[model samples]
Target: MKKTLLFNILFYFVIISFLYSAGETSFNFLKISQGARQSGLGEAFTGVADDVNAIYWNPAGLAQLTRQQVCLLHSVWLVDVNYEYLAYAIPVIGVGTFGIYGTFLAGHITITDENPVTGQYIITDDIARASDINITLAYAKKLSEIVGDNSVFSDMYAGLNINITMENIYEDTGNGFGTNLGILYYPRYQNYSFGLMILNAGIASERPTLPFAIKLGFGYRFSFENILSPFTDEGYYKFSENDSALAIDLIYYPIEQTTKANFGAEKYWNLNKFHSVAVRLGYKFGSDLGLLAGLTVGAGYRLTLNENFQFDFDYAFVPYGDLGESHRISITGKMFGPAETNYFENKEEAVKYYKEGYELLYNKKYAEAILKFSESLKRYKNYAQAYMGMGACFLRLGKKETAKKVYELALQNDPNNQKLKEFIESTKWDIK
Candidate 1:
């Protein structure tokens, strides 16, 4: 089935490339970015595509989603044009994730026509309307599920997007079809990802070819906790829960024969478990238009409605040099079903025990700390930090061999942790 799908995608691309080369393309609206979060990031979103907006950035990112999501975006462009986008995504149990999205760009213009016989210009109507609309259906699946536990294909995802587009300009109308192929790779136990996409592989019989392009990108996330231990040697631990991500994308436009590079960074602060605020900044380079069209900034807020529901709002500001500035806003909602249950009955209770364990360990109460860490693990079996605390308790109790074993278990749960690896190696001599 996979082979057949691959063949069909290639065949479609070949046919579309031929048709696109034979026709003159005119629908530039297809190249416009939609989601406010992505637009704020200089459209460098292919690698950080984690929300419903992934339908437009890289559909393969849908594989990372575990719940259903809906997103809406509205933007006011230069010359009074209005652009809007809507997207919804849902996961299908063991199969994969499916998404549907639509983008519309509309504007009003003055129209005039010349009389054939009199050779005189005549105004048929004072106002004329023009619009472009695109609708897409996409699917993404993890290759690990199909290929089994093979290391090479694990954490890899493939996706396909099919789009139908219509353009209307005064008396002229055009229709087209396009496809996007994308892949995303998330290494096991790592907070980074890589992505590649071939976008707008299609042609219109009556219009010019779509804005065909290829994009390659990567993203990395940094997480921080407990940053203020040195400020006050008090027993109280000050923790700042935050995450920051950096993303870069290189895009090649085939028709324009140009390449553009986009860079973006975002920092998120979690006020609590249920709310967060994010600041974003980005820059674009190698734009055919000019160098000044590179700066972008944006912000976002997320609110958790319940264990199963969340809402997100994002805004972006983009300047187009002399043309003007563009502002975009997007709202998204996510719903998690029963299948996506929380790991603990009460996360606060587990965290309390974990923190107590750490405090006991700091006070040199090894036996008591071991019991507290074990209790924490009973509430959250997959807590790697709790395992680390247990290992530390064992080390303080002079059970180096046991400590080495506990640390190794922690490494199993968090395979990509460099600090954990170093700690384990340092304890190797103690194991004997």
Candidate 2:
């Protein structure tokens, strides 16, 4: 009886936290871990992104990349805390780029009720399940007009993100929506960059509370090898492309009733196409101070039979004192384009499904939209639009399982799609 009472109290707090859009206590875990490659270097991700994971750190960096890539990360922390992150970046044909991201944190806890009368370890009636998940869809576009023809300034890129966030505690569940914006600026002649972004800015619901915060950082790349410099009569000719680059960054963030500043640096060495290594070091300062360090070991190789097909592997390690440590690993298989040109694969397929499903749902064809979205899933199982459509359809159909799964998948792909999460819960309990 006492255990049940204690659990009931804790359950009440969890439910209250969500409904009130409370601080990290209830859904704080939703904060995604830094990219595996970046985190392994000690949470220095804010300044060291080169691939799909760039979406999470600095979307502007996407402008510096020339290929299409996909990455997935999984990690286990102390006390059974589990985390997962995924990203896909596609360089568009003349248009720019887009990235999709998702992150999840889950853990279990037992709530025990102690009887004041019995004064002993008694029955435990409450099992607590905690999870924070979000899905994000982001697009970054280079403004050629804004940054044209400057040898020292290559281009400026802007990105926008839509997110779905959700949480559950025993009998009570709450959901919300959020948004993020990012900008990238790189010099045409340099390997360094400056970035700015705002994350998790918005309200929990219609009232429009919980404003946004900003993060700004500058990074410089340093390289020991004169890989980009040419050997000339003078012994060495220097250029931005000829030398390995070293990078450093300073970042500021306001969140969870606290403000934080971080500084870090990374060094990259190009051993060969089949091997490369980077070392990252950073410091996070806030109400608590912690050191972040990461090491990345990467390898890329071409298949003998198919030059177009290439394989890449990356591993990273990140540790936080009170939060424990995170380890991330990813592998990629991609097919090169014509003459090594940049292009996004399966884009029309993604857009088509989204358009068709949106039309049907808006037209009140919930059932038809469900079918269309499920079909879309068959084509792009990683697409968040289809999952979102499915979730909306399930809401209309009064099917909780479909709604839950669809919302979960949507959140996995976008990690910032809070609307879907809120709708899933409200629809489940018939809450307004």
Candidate 3:
């Protein structure tokens, strides 16, 4: 029975969509993109979608998320019009990621009525309001998890968004429903991805035609270290630290018979272990709306609260020619599973640093080697190999007291290891 009800709802929605496509359409508010990051990127986010905002840009991107997140955005538009959006996403282990989102666009206007016979005007209400509300539920799944490995579909992801919309303009009210479908492909190579989507494919009550459109997008991201080594220690560069990305999208409005192009770029700089910043710029072309609606600029900051929680804030500035400018602000919170370790807390990363330290020791770079071993211990305090490496580096630098202390700490983490016991015994004679 539930399936039947869902089918009926979809059938009616399609009929409404067809009826609206035959003539004209309404509900232009649905076309406005949400989230400060996306707006700053000229709405070219279909390919770069990777956050809770993906519920509006490209649902398939939700498959890439592994944690729970919530995002809120508020926009100060021209002429006192206000726009607000909120979204949340959660990942289900072995299944997929699910998300819900809502958007509101509203404004107040003066209402007046005239007596036709006397030609006199009477003020009905000074503060009448119009609003558009859209709520959506979305889901995304990675094909590799479902179809097994070594297949053509392994790199593909699919997602769907179902939305219900309500529009209130003074005394008139309209209701509608629609769906968005999207797919993403990540090639075996790193830093490249592609996405395609069909947007707003459904119908409305008062306005039959939905804002049907199609989008194709491409994105690439690479670390600065990939081209030039920034580490002065003559060691292997870290690939995950500093990065930049570029994305482009081609959008088509079938009903309006128009095509548009969007371009976006971003650079991320890590300030410390717990804080980072991003700068973004975007441009749009081939839009008939306004002459100055092309360029956008924005910035974002991220703070890690702990191993399990993080917070982000973003801002965007968009110009609309004679229509003035719009400012968008967004806040996001992310929470990870208790059992899962974050990037900085992973033992594998510590091991990598420990191995690098061993290499520096072989090259007889005592100070640089000590720094590498200390970095490893910062990530994993119980890393026995890193402690031993630190001890060896100190010994090479003729610091017998430091070497003895370090060896004792290593034995504490590996009390049963015979090699550590022998090393600690040998260090004891040096301390004497």
Candidate 4:
């Protein structure tokens, strides 16, 4: 019954899209790219919607979030125009994910009039403000909940965005309501993904139509561990995440009766568990602003501040022929670490660090051993071996009290561990 309802909704949505008015849509600013990471990726993020930016690109991606996130983006567009965007995504354990996406665009305009005496254009001393603002509320859920079994349909997700859009040009103002519907499929393995979205599919009071469009996207990622399994352990890299990703997006703008394609690639480098960097290149396949669509360059930096906080910064450089260049930057803060999301993969990496820490401890390098043990625990919180190693490092450094406390904490997590019990009993006076 639920599948029948879903099929009906999707069927009607596609039918209604072709019936909307074309070639005279207002509120065109709705089509502008909103996120830095996406803009750098040639605006092809519909498929790779893994972050808070997904609120705008494809709300269906929000269903994959294990924790909450907030993002702010700013861009200096061509001419005297600039825009700011903010996105927030929060997951509700059993229900679904909720998202808020907003956009504010401001442009400077000069008021002008024609003089009858000389038929000349003269600037008036009147204030002119050209502005646009859009706020959307979104919700997403995985299809598995309705199917009663996750084994087959776990990767399918659907979402909807309700929009409130307003525009102001001098003394004229218009307000409208619209919606975006999207679907995304991403398996647990995290190697590839696909997405479809229909944007701005509603009406306005004053304008005949909105900037309606359809987007289809696909993305793939290649990890070194998988490609170099001959030299790796269990096809998993021990140190960090190193991979290459590629994405392609096809966009059809009904208002203009035009179609375009975008291509993008990114190379990721993880220096360590705490820090990562990436380089991106993107291109659009068509004419843009009277010139051929050119290349776009971008870079990203991410730092894991601690177990509960992570920060990301991204920048994009885009060129527009005679119109000059546009620069975009964004900052995102996430509430959880990678371990909370990729459990098993992180566990594998954690064991490697624990082994290194054990070697350091055997060599009498207490401080270094402590650092490695801490890294291991960061990736897998309940790692009993890592906890024991840290405690031994403190004991060797003459911090008997600290070592006793660490051992006791380990016992709390692993009460059945005979070694931990024996260590606590032996260090009774130190613990007291």
Highest lDDT scorer: 3
Q: Which prediction has more favorable TM-score, 2 or 3?
A: 3
State the local distance difference test value for candidate 3.
0.77
Ranking by TM-score: 1, 3, 4, 2
- Candidate 4 local lDDT, 1-432, one digit each (tens): 111112222222222232222336777777677778787888888887878878888999888787889999999865547789999989887899999989998765555566666767666665466678999999999888878644677678899999999987655688999999999987653467899999988898777778889999998766644556425321221223426778899989866888888888887788887898988889877644444335778999989777678888999997766656789999988896342332233788789999999999999998888878867865777777887888888888887776776677678779999967986896655544
User: Which candidate would rank higher by lDDT, 2 or 4?
Assistant: 4
lDDT of each: 0.77, 0.57, 0.77, 0.76
Best by TM-score: 1
TM-score on alpha carbons, each prediction: 0.71, 0.61, 0.70, 0.70
User: Candidate 3, residues 1-432: lDDT per residue as tens digits?
Assistant: 111112222332333234223235666667777788887787888886778888889999888887898999999866677889999999998989999999987776555556666766665545566677999999999898998857999888899999999987666689999999999887542457899989989988987667889999998776755544324321221224326778899988888777888898888788886898999999888644455668889999989777679888999998866556789999998888431222346587789889999999999998998888877876777787888888888878887876777777788888888978876675544555
Off by over 4 Å in 3: 1-23, 115-126, 225-242, 289-291, 338-432
| Candidate 2 residue 88 C-alpha distance from true site, Å | 1.3
Q: Which regions of candidate 2 deviate over 4 angstroms? A: 5-27, 45-48, 123-126, 145-154, 206-211, 226-236, 240-249, 254-259, 268-272, 287-312, 332-432
Ranking by lDDT: 3, 1, 4, 2
Task: Name the regions of candidate 4 deviating beyond 4 angstroms.
Answer: 1-23, 224-242, 290-292, 336-432
lDDT of 4 at 418: 92
Q: 24 in model 2: Cα distance from truth in Å?
A: 7.6
